[model samples]
Target: MYDVVIVGAGPAGLSAARMAAEAGLKVALIDDQPRIGGQYFRHAGVRRIGGILAPRFGRARYIHTSLSTLGRCGVEVLNEATVVEISADRTLTVAFRGSITQLQGENVVIATGARERVIPFPGWTTPGVIGAGAAQNLMKASGVLPGSRVVVVGANPLCLLAATSLLRCGVKIVAVCAPSRPRVTFNALLRLMRRPDIFLRGVGYLLMLKLYRIRMLSDYRVTDVIGDAKVTGVITRRFAEGLPPSEERLDVDLIVVNDGLLPNIELASRAGCEIEWEPSTSVWSPKRNADFETTIPHVYAVGDCVTASGVENSLLEGEIVAISIAASKDVGERGRLRRLSRLKWRWRRLQKFRSAVVELTVKESLDQRPLTDDTIVCRCEDVSLATINDALCQGVQDLNALKAETRVCMGRCQGRTCMHTVLALLATAVGKEPDQFKPPVPRLPLRPVKVGDWLKKF
Candidate 1:
């Protein structure tokens, strides 16, 4: 059994592993990705700048040193390892590569990170439509552009970053549809002033937007994705407009939507950790104490899997959680407290730096109900809004009941892609807050794992 088993290789997981191993703990870092850098540290064959703030000059160089530290510190790294399930006794059933393996850990740190929140619209399932974050993922991981011409929609700041990257890749951005009106834009710019580094990055995006002559279609939301077989265009309308809104169509091969992100907390919830839906962020996060420990005694939640503040905060949180684990292991309480005190100071400084980022990057929800009534809310099950509405009309009061009635989230994705949309529709129909509804039931095999693979190995 290892002293610490980290479930992601992102900023948080890497930092936690390095620190725990440096403290003389046997560390095993697991990630589904093929490389150490998670989605945030995706380096595609060149020097990567931006994202990570390091003294090493470039992100590529920083990642190099991080992997070097994990190596020199003797952390056993398992790339392409998918943690399928966690048992009551802290045994992690991991599907690594072709076979499955059982890992018993003294302490488990979950840093699975976050996934893009995509609001469904008519024709969003078209071949060329993608999440703006997914578009960036494709570009960052493989040096690929999403499409020749793209229409980026939604209100998240990730739209700005993806647009900048796509432009650098020589992709033509037809338009960027977001709620960038005067008051909201001014507040974001003014609020971001406290963080000079972030302000400069925002300026860089604006400069690129100006340079490329891309339309910053302010206050706009995608009403519908207009395409038959593939993405041919998108219909955008202002959010503040009247019923039967004035629509503008933009012809493009790709439609990248960036609504927001939800913490990937399936594994944590499946492990019986308490979860609370945070109204401020409009995302459900694993409930953690001040010590960052989950409800499970030896399990800890850190990074974007807990809160998607930023990379710097995630790195700090990772270190803090590692200290918590080290302290709990009956390793000289006095010495552990002394080192934990030092790490907490670093954590405070990093948290202060990210406070402005959280304020400026809060996403606004869109009215996705009027999307022609036939939009596929759950792509995995092909469940449409009409189907959900029909179920609601048939006396489905609870969200879980509606799921049973319509098979809304009983799909392969396990409600990752469309749970929020389903919740929103039900909340509006029931005349109650979305948080008032119960969360989707958490199940074992949090991620998809074949029975044969585990039977053969474990």
Candidate 2:
């Protein structure tokens, strides 16, 4: 038994584990990735394994220091460990490197982070089309560029980051076609100024774009990805009002697109924690109280898994949740209340900024381009928009019902890649809000665990 078992090694999980262990609680940190840093600090955990340090910088250095602190605090670190199941008694069954082990924690923290939301366009499943987050993972983890020439599409800010990262990697960007108009972009930029650090980072990205003389088109949406077997080019259409409609084609090997980020809440939902859909972000997260404790007693969720705020907010949540858990255990009683109050005040203030960012950036709905019947919605199950429409015609009224009729979310990904799009379709069909529909039933094992590994648990 451990005093605390935290899932994920992202900013929140790392901070929580370090703080809890520093308070003298036995702690175990688990992550599926071989590296400790999540998306924001991708590949930051690599050290001088053979006496050669990786090129480190701001994000990398901070994570390295936190990892070192975790080591000094005696936290058991389990990299590449997947938590497959959680029992009613709060025991976690983890599959690690072809074996299984069970851990019971007095307190458990879920910080699995978020996944990139990809809005489907025609031919999106082509070999060269990838999510902005996935493109970053490819570049960061393996030093592989997504393509020689790329066109970024969508209204989200992640598109800019991906384009800039590709620029740094010497990949040529053909253009960036955003669906939002110039006014929306300007508003978001003004709101971004509230956080100077973020504002500067975004400005630096824009500066790179301008310095390279790359084309940045506003109020343009990707109508289709034109390729037979792989992406060769993309079809973009201008959507601005009071302007003659025009179509443009860009020759490119890659199309990197992002809608937003959605919480990876499968583990928490499967563990029987209550979940609520937040209309503001259009993502469902594990329901938690002011203390950040989930409906399941002694189980807490923080960071992007709670909501897809930025890295700084996630780090702060980690500290607050750890302090709450430690105080509950009476391990660090002195000044706990005062520290919690101060941290929460900071958190709430940051959340206000987050709200403004979301308001300025997040659209009421995805790109309003007409989704063709041939567009692939669920790649894993090979479900198409036509099939979904057929199901809706047959009286499917909710996501769970639609899933039963069409098997959309029953694939290996467990709705990670496909749920948001399906939810949008269903909500539109039913003439209700996204939150009005019931979420798909949570299934287990949360991830695929081989039969051999399960047997080893015995």
Best candidate (score: TM-score): 2
- Quote the positional error of residue 401 for candidate 2 in Å: 4.3
> lDDT per residue, candidate 2, 168-262, as tens digits?
76778999888765344665555565577776776788899999999989888788888888989988988789999899999999999888899
Considering summed lDDT, which 10 consecutive residues are worst modelled in model 2? 48-57
- lDDT, model 1: 0.78
Whole-model lDDT values for every prediction: 0.78, 0.83
TM-score of each model, in listed order: 0.90, 0.92
Candidate 1 ranges with C-alpha deviation above 4 Å: 46-58, 180-194, 239-245, 328-359, 366-369
Candidate 2 has an lDDT of: 0.83
Instruction: Give the alpha carbon lDDT tens digit for every residue of 148-206 in model 1.
Output: 88888765568888887777767789988776443345655554654567568767888
